[model samples]
Target: MTTSATRQQITGARSIVVKIGSSALTELTTGLDVRRLDALADAIEARMRAGSDVIVVSSGAIGAGIAPLGLKARPKDLATKQAAASVGQLALAHAWNTSFARYDRTVGQVLLTAHDVSLRAHHANAQRTLDRLRSLGAVAIVNENDTVATNEIRFGDNDRLAALVAHLAGADALVLLSDVDGLYDGDPRKGDATLIPEVGGPEDLDGVIAGSGGALGTGGMASKLSAARLAADAGLPVLLAAAADASAALTDASVGTAFAPRPQRLSARKFWVRHAAEATGRLILDDGAIRAVAGARHSLLAAGIVATKGRFYNGDVVDLADQKGQTRARGVVGYDAGEVAQMIGKSTGDLPADFRRPVVHADDLVAL
Candidate 1:
């Protein structure tokens, strides 16, 4: 079947975010492989021509840099890894541009760090940039800003980044291309392992064990599964498939382990708070707070919180955890850490008027 027709038949997802894994786009000892790049580009172009707005979150800058820098393997140190990404990003971008030129389509490069999606301002900037690119008929090629992003602020792996990007781009669907063909009940290398063709929800992933990534990739089956679930939870259908089956998976959602999405899509603020925003600190809430905040869907109050951990300011993302340090929900704080410390454990009726407002408003919070 034609790629466009197949995709439309699968779902009415007019916009899609396709993540190409590092191992799928490059050779072990060489940089980005031209054949792999062209093949994937061809698939993406077909969808775009079919009138679907397509965005690609590609992870190959480090892999592509390895060959050009004469490195025998992936770099281990942060500095060396950054250097490799610096070189590889240029090559990767150029290759993407050249490959898409085959279909007479233009490519726009968008490099993002965790802060870009976490901070309200930067996140909006990214949204506008990609939206503008789409309006101009340009396919956005997004990646984490590996060159300058530090471990402290980076989006650990491209899989998570892709999921966050999928939501940020307002994509209707998310397709993650990995080294493996599909998610399995166990290690695929084992004789008894069976491919899980469909995932209805989180319960299906209980006790599932998947292997880690190869030498050239950062994501593994576990990460892919997490990303798929994250996207699916936000009402975005997700497909996890082998990179070799890029065209098939991109077109035929049934070709991979398809994740069914929630019928009701989350609002933009809820999606960002639950997935993209990074927690700057932790809020230790009592048992009553946990139930009230997460269960009753009540706004988190200072009286419910027992203590605060870490330094954070007003409007920053903070985890609302229990005494055992288990996070139950996430929300945007209304006061700084210093201010919150003063009001911890104080009842609204007992506190002054200025300090009685919800510590974290209900609208700004999301249950995990």
Candidate 2:
């Protein structure tokens, strides 16, 4: 476990990522809640006015569109969900725009799918865009592109998305505004739960009965906990509190469960390679290959590879696994699956001029 941040330090973090869960933003029957939006916008505006840059990851599009689309409750099918998102995203953006207008602040909408952050080029583009948006003094309101994202490609919840965004934008801290006040040792609904004030590492989460959010929401305390750990691992602290306490939480008034960050900061390339890229295939490596790639952190030569499994392209991310079936590293394969298969067990010098290089370059590889 790392040393937790003091209240004063937590309150002073300048770049922050604020995530608002669906349940916090939308009503079950009435749809979009203007009052909640206004209150949230006000808090965010206050933070910005105080010279802090804020990035918002909001989840409420599908939830907000359910009533207007004449659906009884949250949609079940993918098509229905997409339709609702298409309709609701506009309303979500509009509500934010209107709310921010009251405080004379600007908001930028950034919709992303898993693919946006998975591919190297797309990831860089998104990062650059976010940097530019913040440089211009605009708060970015981020959401998943649910209209095109299937379950396989979606982030699963905004909690995880916010963690990734925090890293992407180089945020100093993350605030997860949930329906609950903070993480509890047991189920708070059971009336005997106790709020855990600080989490320095995984050990702090021991014996906590974490659970998902309401049916209308995609994330719950469990997801928020996972997100907090993820951000903490990347050297970004996390504050989990109720949406109603946004002002207090942002001001670092000790209102939420704060997860302290690791002392060492992760490099951007390594962070993206490890967490963002989607592995499309697995490459089995011999002991020597493991020692070279995993132990020494070297590029994967074709001769060290014992075999390859699954279809992957030249630029697709692949997992390098030991014969024992444990993934030791992940990297963008320099050669396609077929190309690597043909070169398996062949020494670099024995291969043709064009086929003599490493299967995955060192720059593209990150030890897991």
Candidate 3:
């Protein structure tokens, strides 16, 4: 996909996820910027009236709390950050609700943790909830469950979360509204920097000097690129534009960067296994097993088992490693770790009467 095609795709998108960064949503002197919030709400409401489904993934809880709590800057520790988020989430939702109320539009708040999307059942359920909310003519406002998420397991930024949400909800497009207009050849603050209007895939971002955003936000150009990759892989185009010009970006105007979607779409299970689920264990396979699993794209068998690591249950996603301990694939297992250990090194015919299923089905597997 080229820049022109990406722009065209953005223009045709009927469903979209618009992510607003903290800097774009907050005031330097006050907590929430009511004026900017109103502008964003108006643009979204107009789109809704036009019959487009829109979901907003907004980041500004901490920034919104800064003024009220008298904090000089964003908190450095997780506890303070969580406290700030708890306080600011209320303010943020209230502002959005109030703004949308003027247009007779209702808003619903949804806070999610990384684990929420990692589990297949939870992932599917979340998607259903979001879909129903949209069907009810309410804009679903989402944010990470920062108060409960630990540092090591956090989504880290709303950019990636928004992308994942777009994928989960089966959105047609993703609009990332930030302070910067779009990606550039170099940092836009530099004299020679030039805007790169479109990205087809990961290859296009090579050598591009994408920079970070304001202090209030965790994401930068790099995170947005990662978000675009995730969305594109899930068969959704992405628009990276300035929040100030959000209406133009959402419209047919080419006011920001756009990343075209891949032509192929992965199945819901494969998408969750590849992008959402966390690996719970590792299964080391022999040479023949590696060839069969990677080259032939077949399932793992007990005869090919070399070793196993970590405790895991049936239906859990696990890393399939080669003899060299390198991850070659990931898939949902058919048996628990203990059961797999008992069947290791045994041929299918020699397995116990109870252990008759394939260890990892091909349909459930995804190559790394």
TM-score of each: 0.95, 0.92, 0.94
Better of 1 and 3 by TM-score: 1
Pick the winner on TM-score between candidates 2 and 3.
Answer: 3
Candidate with the greatest TM-score versus the true structure: 1
Error of 2 at 177 (Å): 0.6
Alpha carbon lDDT at 341, candidate 2: 92
Show the colliding residue pairs in model 2: 213-220
Kindly provide the TM-score of model 1 when superposed on the true structure, using C-alpha atoms: 0.95
Off by over 4 Å in 2: 1-9, 352-356
lDDT by residue for model 3 (1-368), tens: 23387777767777888899998999756889999999999888877777789999999988888788888888889999999898999999999999999988889999999999997788888898899999999999999988898998889899999999998998888999988898887887767887878778778878987666568988988898888788888888888889999888877737878787889877778888888898999999999988988889998889999888999999999999987788988999999999999988889999877787789999999887
lDDT of each: 0.88, 0.88, 0.87
Clashes of 3: 0
What RMSD, rounded to one decimal, does every model reach? 2.5, 2.5, 2.0
lDDT of 2 by residue, 121-227 (tens): 88889999999999998889999999999988888889999999999989888899978998899998989999898887889888988887787888888888888
* lDDT minimum window of 10 residues, candidate 2: 1-10
Displacement of residue 128 (Cα, Å) in model 1 is 0.6
lDDT of 1 by residue, 277-314 (tens): 88999999999999998898899988898989999999
